[model samples]
Target: MTDEPRLSAQDMIERLGPVLSRRTRIRAVTALLAGVAGAVFVGTLWWSEPGPLPGRTHLAFALFTMFCLTWAGYGGWLVTRRVALFATDRVIAAWIGLAASLATTAVIIVVAVQRGTSVGLALVVGGLFVAVALVLAVRAHARRAALLRRMHELSGREER
Candidate 1:
């Protein structure tokens, strides 16, 4: 083995630069803004209704509000956390995001159809979400593969 010393945690972190990248920061901000805006809009609408709504309507409003709040909380947690995400973590996160996007799209389309609303608009929005998620997933997988390749190359060199 070579006599080169191993990198310390601080050195490794310095070499990696900022763990919370610009893209991640932007994503967290977007999620927070969207979630808070959605929650506020739904809450206001529910509160300002003229007449007494059905139990099912109230339940729906509550569920939607909670969902928005949950997303906001997740965003807030991500923003506050200082942990660095590894390649495997990124891959898992990307998959989770893809699943969530697909589920959300399905729900939107189903709701639009059930309500006799403009299914076209719903489909367009859902398509956009799915496309974005797919792109992110692909990028994540590529990044992981590149990292793994680099790791193997470095290890091979160390052995020699």
Candidate 2:
């Protein structure tokens, strides 16, 4: 007889509640921090010039926050699922995050262009987000690789 205990769907969900809540709280706090930092950065840049274009910058920051939150939520979901996140999942998540960032960047760029703001600024913001995404994705990939390697080594030793 197996020692594993059977659990129903509701039981599983109930058991996962605390874990999910913890994940959600962490994500929310991190998102809040990012939002504040983004707002400050964009606000400083947008208001640096003597004009009425701060509104466009605010809009850009809003979109950027939305994208970041969405990406973070995806990442948090992956973590909460307890899946053996492989390098492939990391790469895929990075791609999805990049896609979300690019989409938001495009929208902001369009807004900035319509408001007669400098396009270079929007490009800079987009590039910054891409860079961050790349770093995170690479780190996640490395972690996954290390974990797999350790598992392989342990399993091989058990056969001796």
Clashes of each: 0, 0
RMSD of each: 4.4, 8.6
Q: Which stretches of candidate 2 lie over 4 Å from their true place?
A: 1-96
- Ten residues in a row with the worst lDDT in model 1? 84-93
Compute each candidate's TM-score over C-alphas: 0.59, 0.48
Off by over 4 Å in 1: 1-4, 8-16, 54-67, 87-100, 115-121, 148-160
In candidate 2, position 126 carries an lDDT of 89
Compare the candidates by TM-score and give the number of the best one: 1
Could you tell me the TM-score of candidate 2? 0.48
lDDT of each: 0.74, 0.64
Tens digits of per-residue lDDT, candidate 1, 8-38, equal 4444654786778888888777877888999
